[model samples]
Target: MFDSRHIQTFAEVVRTGSYAATARDLGYTQPAISQQMKALERAAGTPLFVRAGRGLRLTDAGRLLARHATGILSSIETAHGQLKAITRLESGRVRVCAFPAANATLLPATVARLAASHPGIRVELLEEEPPDSLRALREGRCDLALAHSLGDDEEGVIQVPLLDDPLLALFPAGHALAGSGRVGLEELAAERWIAGCRRCRGHFLAACARAGFAPDIAFTTDDTLAVQVLVAAGAGIALVPGTALPLLRHTEVVARPLTPALGRRVSAFVLAGHETAPVTALLLRTLSEAAKDLEPAAV
Candidate 1:
């Protein structure tokens, strides 16, 4: 009979594309990966892969076995998830991957609420960008992922809208628009801007473009705090989520709703089928509650 261990070994090797990566991923030695592959091949009575210079290619038989391996691995995962779900609240870890903006604002309160409600549920948090968060969902690295939608839901995740954080203007307290409760986007036409990730979400850039000006980025950084600090220091003005405003308060910065204001919607994601996990459901509930009192940054 094809053993579970053999099926897993084959899957890891294929998933990672290298024996070394499989070893690191599974926390096994390279020799152990080799041993498992040999045993799996012996069970199938055929060689599964042909070694190339630094990589290996699956044979036709290997490809056929891989097809079966997928189902086998998925079944095993389902069984394990079921067990975890049944026992999770009593003693287990819930992993969450969140984006930077959430990290600054709603996330801390949400996590605190969950911890207070369910002390037994050990929750581990990871800060990842949208695609990385979604990848964690697909690859089983995280139970729940908090991320913003880039307007495309192509990752096949089950996404639940968490809350909307309006995009706001972030600038030094003394900047021209600081005293205004809100300012029109078009008013900042010629100001130097502190850009967010250009490669990922075009939201910040798009907002500027729609406002009829292209930002001359004085600096670009992904760390939300750093972005705020730079703007506070008068390095440049930035457009940021309302969530980020609270974190930037001590720096004497100001945040105001933009005219034709845009909001970057936050969402929680789980792998399509594993949405029923108790910890995930509870945390989602907690996040919703936390968002209610989130007054956006007062400044």
Candidate 2:
């Protein structure tokens, strides 16, 4: 069998195109680098390199090995990293995918806590809504996902409930219902509506339907800040999640709890068997803690 160190030397030689250069880079003698290549070629039962004047040329077998070298090296590196992290729990990376509201509200605190507690652990964040975030988690693009559902059970993954983010009604400060402690969906049926993301809009439609009216949607946008801006301009009223209320930038807009209290359950999702992964588990705990902090004050 070809030794991994020999394969490493071969890949380096392929990159630098010089045995002498590879040796210099890897801190070995030139003859040692050449000997390692000979071993690799013998294990493969084929000539991997050919002499071409003053330079070396890769034979067909060498080209084939080179094609696979990158992936092989990457897998080996990842395995080593995982082993090291398992041994120390001091260094690792966790990629997280979350929706905008949770990204704004929960991720900052979660990342901060993780950084303070485990300075060597790094977090990479991406923003995607529901099914997409879940897809990313399953595809291995993200280690964790902050996803929300309107009471439907998500299959094919481990789900940990974080919090229920209530949907709040937003109106212009001077609007008649703005001063009300709680506004019923049907009460705003005649007013022009500004819709948010697809999921949020779906929830809004469902809530309005339950209240016996269809909203007259005049504007649609996925940006919470824009929704607030529109509401402040008296362009249209909107329903925004409580977690996103803290991001409200327009003072002319007022938020109140919905009469029936519609909400989405926010949760952390991981691959079915990976919930106990060290870094991911740490993040899950941090997210739960952050959500608890937001619970009492949200909206």
Candidate 3:
């Protein structure tokens, strides 16, 4: 049987395209790399690499083995992680990613609750946008990612809905529409707008399209506090997420529900089979319970 180390070296060489580079990456000498390659070839009973020009190239057999090696390495890593988690469910580490607003509002409460219930479980949190959060989950950089879906559902990921956070209109206290209670997107079409990030801008445009008019963005920003400050100073109106309300330090800005509510559907994503991890299950429960108070009341 080929040693795992030898197979790993072969994979690294395949990836790096040079035995010298792979050796540098893996902390092995050039001779050691050669020994590993030779041993792997011996175990396979065939030469895996062939000299071509100034560099080496993989044989057809080598290419086939490299494809299988990726899955094998991934499985080994997953098994090791599972074993570590299972052996210490309460004391294990759970790495999580969340968008900024949720990290500020809901996640802190959930983390507090989880710490109270499972003090030994070390939960590491990463703040990222929805796209980055999903990427982290796909790459196994995080155990759970709290993300907001605009429309697309990620394949190979299991998403558990936590809550719906509506986009509300933020107006200066003395603005004519401030006291309207609720307003339609059409009503604000002519008003100068404070734009958010790319995702937020997309949602804003989508909402406007539904209302039959385009918005004229006067300024663009993604900082929650900056958006509030700009809106409060009468730079422009904005559609801010409900979860971001808590982050607004200015009382000069008021949030009113939209005529036809448009918003993000927040969910927690985990790798297809990773939801079974004891810590993941526990944290999911905690997050769900914490989100209960954030949901809108039935009309």
Candidate 4:
């Protein structure tokens, strides 16, 4: 077996082009570096390096070992980083996939809390809808997935309840129903509507159906900020998830709770068998705390 230290020293000598420099960089004496190289050559049963005019040059065996050493050393370093991260949540990366609303509201606070508590940890947030987010988690593209669904357990993924976000009505400030304490879907059926995302629009459609009317959808968009902008411009009213309120950039829009208290449950998804990871568990705890602190919607 090729000793990792020998391979590491060999790679360092190749990079630095001098045994003395490699020794200095690695905090070892020049003789120690020469001993490691000689041991590596004996293990290979060949002279791995040859003396050039002023520096050491790699032989064919040395070149091959150097190429393999680079990848082996990289993998070992990555493993060490992961192990360290697991041991103390000190350093590593956590990739998170979340939908737009959750990214806007809960995720920011959760990420902030985790980052403050564990400054060495790196967090990556990707925006994806429920289905895509779950897919990313299953494909190993993300460590955690924040999703919104109608309280259904998906196969192969474990769901951890994060929050129950109510769907609310949003309209321009001057709209007749804007100031209402609560708005019924049936009451606004005749007005033009800015349809939200596919899932959110489906929920709105179902609610309108239950209320015995079909909404007149004037436009469809998946962007929460754009929805707010359209509503502020009086393009139409919208049924927005409660979490989207924080993303509203337009002050002309007013949010009112839906009369029947319709809502979707937001949950975090991870591979069914994998949930005890140290960084993931830590972030999940922070997310739970942020969810608990969220303001409850008025019915």
How displaced is residue 190 in candidate 1, in Å? 0.4
Estimate, for each residue in 31-114, the C-alpha lDDT of model 2 and write its tens digit. 999999999999999999998887789999999999988888889899998788764768888899999988898999888888
Query: What is the per-residue lDDT of model 3 for residues 1-299, given as tens digits with 9 covering 90 to 100?
Result: 97888888898999988889998998889999999999999999999999988688999989989999998888888888878756666477889999888888888888888788778788898988878888988888899999886367678889899998888899999999999878988999899999877765677797799898888888988788888999999999998888887787898988888878888888999998888878888888899998996565311
Q: Model 4 over residues 1-299: C-alpha lDDT tens digits? A: 78988988999999999999999999999999999999999999999889998898999988898889989999989998879767798876789999887888898888788778888778899998878888888889999999887356778777889888888889899998888998877888688988866665676787889999988888899888788889898898888888777676787989998787888888888887667878778878888888877746422
Give the total clashing residue pairs for model 3.
0
Ranking by lDDT: 2, 3, 4, 1
In model 2, residue pairs whose N, Cα or C atoms come closer than 3 Å (at least 3 residues apart or on different chains), thus clashing, are: none
Residue pairs in collision within model 4: none
Q: Give the residue spans of candidate 4 off by over 4 A.
A: 1-82, 295-299
TM-score of each: 0.68, 0.73, 0.70, 0.73
Clashes of each: 0, 0, 0, 0
TM-score ranking, high to low: 2, 4, 3, 1
Determine which window of 10 residues in candidate 2 has minimal summed lDDT.
Answer: 148-157
